[model samples]
Target: MSCMKTAENVCSTGIRIKDKKLTWKRSWQKYKYLYFLILPGLVYLIIFRYIPMYGLAIAFQDFTVFGGVFGSPFAGLKNFKTLMSNTLFWQAFVNTIRISGLKLIFAFPAPIVFALLLNEIFHPKYRRVVQTISYLPHFVSWVVLAGLLDVFINSSNGVLIMLLKSLKFNPPNIMTSNTWFVPMLIVTDIYKNVGYSSIVYLAAISSIDLGLYESAVIDGASRFRQVWHITIPSMLPIICILLIFNLGNILDGGFSQIFVLYNSLVYRTADIIDTYVYRVGIVSSDYSIGAAAQFFKSLIGMFLIIGANYTVRLFDQKGLW
Candidate 1:
């Protein structure tokens, strides 16, 4: 009787497993096209993002081109220790924090404010024209934009310099000046990205129920009050999500922009982790140190993302979890 009961239970479990497989197979068949649509993106992420993560192990090893990642001798935390002791690395780290913080404080909100202002515009044509003009800069390559900036602000022959000279005002060489380099970076970054970034906020704003605004109007709430109470509150989730994402990228510090714009004269102000890593890793061929820097940056970014998400959750706000 015991043996018979055991056989019956095994049979039932087997049947349940088969049923689940069949259900999964049917669902896959139904949504095969959707899966197919995402396959390319999945492949790209796997190939470019996930596969490259394996190379990060080099940070723990004395990596050499001929020795390769597998053949490299393990150094454990030696590279990271070296990085910590290096004054240049610390300077770059501090500069990255300062520049990224400045951008977060100033550039991050430019898009939101721009989007809100645009939403208030009654003229659709004019709004589109403004958006198009603003977005055009984002499509321009940083290399090209940097060159344009150099020309436009050239201390000797720049259009800005000429204009300032006309007014009997001396215009400093902004591109080389440590005092102006960071501010220039922030302003240019905001100018380039504000339009593209605002699109998400605009979409968020559009999804807000018009009935809320109408109800507010009926309650004699002013436009500012309605926006403050309804629009901002409605967009808070997205805003929080974006803020968390930005926090994760705190160390990035606009590598492409800085690389193209900065020279030795401005490295004091403009040098960042990415640029420093590129110089140490690729240019200097110190692969382990470079990898260590990147690994450190990634670690900090992960902690920041987790911290930001937890902080948001504490406020009873939705996070990227």
Candidate 2:
């Protein structure tokens, strides 16, 4: 009897599995076109993102170019240990945190505020003009923007310096000054990205139901109150999602912009993990240490994303998961 019962259960499970496969097959057939559309992206991710992950193993090895990944001797945690003990690495790590934190504080909110202000503009043509003007900076490459900044801030004949000199006020070379480097980075980053970043918030705002605003108006709610209660609440999910993404990238201190703008004079305030890795890994050929640093950053980012998602869940909100 027991043997017969086990055989029946096994047969039932097999039937269920077969049914699931058939269901999935039908669903795939129904959405085959949609799947085909995403195939290129999937292939790109597999090639660029997933495939490169294999090289991360070198972080645990000595990772000499001549020896290659497989030929390199396993160094265990030695690379990580060296990374931790290195003063320059620690300085770069601190600078990364400070710069990223400042950007989060200032640059992150600028977009949301700009989006809100843009939404308040009643004239469509004027609003579009403002948006176009704002967005143009985002399309400009960092290299070009940095060059423009240098031209405007150059001590000898810069537009800004000339203006200051006309007023008989001497201005420091902001690009090279350690004191001004970080502030310049923060301000310029905000300027470059605020318009582009606001696009997501604008999308979120647009998705909000018009009926909510109508209902708020019926209740005699002021514009500010309506926006406070209706617009903000509706956008919270998107905001949370973006916030989580930003938290995960807390260590990425605008590598391209900083690389284009920074010099040896301001290295104290300007050096960050990405630049450090580029110098040490590609420039000085210290691949193991660089890989270890990158691995550590990736681990931290993963944890931060997980933690942010968990926090969102605790608040009874939807998360990326």
Candidate 3:
């Protein structure tokens, strides 16, 4: 009887395994084209992203170009200790948090507001024109934009400065001022990204059922009331998800933008982890310390992502998980 019972269990397990294999085979057949389409992206990630992750081992070593990763002497936590004690590293860390926080507060909402306003424009052609114009700045390289802004703000004959002078207001070079530099970064970041960011919100807006609006209309709801009550609620999940994503990247601090736009005069406020790493690691050839700093940042970012996702879930909302 025991042997018969064991035989029955094995047969059931085999059947389940067979079912799973058949289900997977059907799914593969259905999505084979989609998989093929994503193959190049997978290859790119494998080559450029995953492969390069092997260099992370340098964080644990006294890395030297002559010795290479495997040949370098294992220094354990010495590099991390050095990084933690560095005043410049701490300053960069603080600047990264402050800049990223300011951006989160101001720049994050700009796109949502812009999307709401853009949705109010009923004329399709005019809406398209505005969207095209807004998206233009996002496509412009930060290098080019930074150069243009430098000319517009730093040149003695800059139009902005010239206008201020003409009005009898002697405006100093705002870019160099620590107080003004961060604000400039925030404004420029919003200007560059708001349009592109709004595309996602607009998509969310489109996905909202029209019936909700119609019902609100039937209930004598004003457009603002309808939007506040219906559209905003519909977008909450997406907003939460994006907020979590942004929190995960809180340490990034817009490296490309800041690196190009900042000068020595504004380094006090503008220097961030990425720039610090570039200076210390690439320029100063302290590769081990830089790697340790980066590894630390990545570790913190991973925790932030997990925490953010957990918080989002706690609110009974969908999360990245």
**TM-score of every prediction relative to native:** 0.87, 0.87, 0.87
What is the alpha-carbon lDDT for the whole of candidate 1? 0.91
Native-referenced Cα lDDT, model 3: 0.89
lDDT of 2 at 19: 47
Clash pairs (backbone) in predicted model 1: none
Q: List the residue pairs that clash in candidate 2.
A: none
- Model 2 lDDT per residue over 1-321, tens place: 225545534544365455454466875875689899999999999999987687888999989888898899999999999999999899899999999999989998899999998999999999888888899889999999998998998878899899999999979889889999999999999989999899999999989999989999999999999889998888888888888888889989999999999988888889999999999998998999889898888888899889988998899888877
* lDDT winner, 1 or 2: 1
Candidate 1 versus the native: TM-score? 0.87
- 1-321: candidate 3 lDDT, tens digit per residue: 226545534544365455454465865875689799999999999989876577878999999999998899999999999999999899999999999999999999899989889999999899889988899889999998998887788748878888889899988888788888999999999999999999999899989899989989999999999889988888899899999989999999999999888888888888999999999988999999988988989989999999999999999998887
Candidate 1 Cα errors over 4 Å, as ranges: 1-47
RMSD of 1: 7.5
Residue 293 CA displacement from its true place in model 2, Å? 1.0
Name the regions of candidate 3 deviating beyond 4 angstroms.
1-47
Q: Rate the local accuracy (lDDT) of all candidates.
A: 0.91, 0.89, 0.89
